[model samples]
Target: MQQDSTSKDSRIALGLALTVRHDGHGGVADDLADLAGLGAWLRAHPGTVPDTERYRADEPDLAAVRAVRAAARALFARAVRPGEPSPADAARLLPVPEALRCLNQAAARTPTVPVLDWADAGPVLRREPADDRADLAAALAHAVIGFLAGPDRPRLRACHAPRCVRYFLKEHPRQEWCKPSCGNRARVARHHERQKRTA
Candidate 1:
């Protein structure tokens, strides 16, 4: 299949940005769990990620996942347009699919969640991030979304450090440091230059 470089980079960057590790014992902090939950979503649905166990019950709610997925689709759909994307164009970009899923999943269970409170209101049960894994999940998801859809969209990019897979928005297009190895290489080269100059 033909690949869309821009979209692929965006997805990978967002995925890496959203990733969080889970303890699996349910004793971890909500914020960390939420972060991992967001990562899980990215893994599932870069196309249609599922709600993490941290966010959902054992049986899993297919309906909840689908609902969040749909909202994410709409957000992305509304954000894109044909033109030379300006800095403000970042604002035009909606939260990607993963962010929308996190938020929607949170909203499905709460009316006063952090980001969801001012945005939408309904029964949603008013659950806390601790009580509602969905809330934390949503927050992490939205973090990447908000970052990607800001005036800094131009900085968003994927890591190019050999086989190391990660994403980074460059501070300058000329900067190529993404992993420690890459940064170390650059540092070593700079040290060599300094020695040669002094010699």
Candidate 2:
């Protein structure tokens, strides 16, 4: 079954957008290779899959998925690290109208059902059955919208480690890298620079 993983932490969508990483030098790596890989990734990160049964049965359109992923990554990169992307780069992002269309289609297919919430003492709404591919597109679109409008949007950052190109939500004011290892690498690089300057 498809679930909303971005409800609690919208960053999950950003993580998905960043599945394809670049070294910023010349190297690149794509984590999602095929439908099976996509399924596995979704299994590891539940709520990402729209309709598990459909996903398991059908072969995903790899070209379409890659196009969406590329557009998403471009948009995120522009938002998080402005001034680095050229005009041509920005033009490659999926147009707002197209993204909205995908979102709307998903919403139309999956209506919301209202239910009483005893714990919260209110009425809650849950999404109906998700159409595998449509839902995935909607989820990605929703996440992008949420992240762009979120208060923590300014905290979105790409890792500064050399040869590493991963985005992360900055947890601390001083955080500049995605992980401790990236931080260590930065420190080591700085140390080498200092030694060269002294020599």
Candidate 3:
């Protein structure tokens, strides 16, 4: 489905936020299980990093990356479902003050040596480095902030399919499940319910 820039960004943020999923059938699954996994995820989702090559070359601190991921997930969870208790000790990972601090830091864009480019049929502006960890945190923070503050925020929803714990941006007014498979599952579940009611 074609989505606007904001929606695309929001989706990316959501993907990051939901790296750890609760498997309703049993245990949980974590995409960022380790440093290698984290690195792979970053490589796959280049949008999450300021400069994929630079980030990969730097070999960012694994501990710091994990911390940022934890903070981002906590912050997004709270934003996605306000008033709900966040993950255990999530506050320590990313407290309100810390998140706001990162947001403010990212908001202030410092001037960098201008570079002329003709990549997009016009000149493109590139800025200097602003602490990698902080930049990533800020990117995630801004993503959630934009999503929450945008019109589409109201349409954000969690999948209702049994044993599924994924969030999705509602495409249609009546859309509920995240995918057609989820919708089919719900339909089968309803059919079972009807049979039980009659029996």
lDDT of each: 0.41, 0.58, 0.59
As a TM-score, model 2 comes out at 0.66
Model 2 Cα shift for residue 92 (angstroms): 9.5
Best-to-worst ranking by TM-score? 2, 3, 1
Who is ahead in lDDT, 1 or 2? 2
lDDT of 2 by residue, 81-181 (tens): 65343222344456656655544454354344454455566666654443324455445555565666676567677676756666677777887787888
Q: TM per model?
A: 0.34, 0.66, 0.61
Error of 3 at 132 (Å): 6.5
In terms of lDDT, model 3 sits at: 0.59
- Model 3 per-residue lDDT tens digits across residues 139-174: 554555566667666666666566555566677788
Where model 2 places Cα greater than 4 Å from the true spot, the runs are 1-9, 22-26, 51-54, 57-60, 81-134
Question: Which regions in candidate 3 have their CA more than 4 angstroms from the true location?
Answer: 22-27, 57-135
Q: What is the model-wide C-alpha lDDT for candidate 1?
A: 0.41
Winner of 1 and 2 under TM-score = 2
Backbone clashes, each candidate: 6, 0, 0
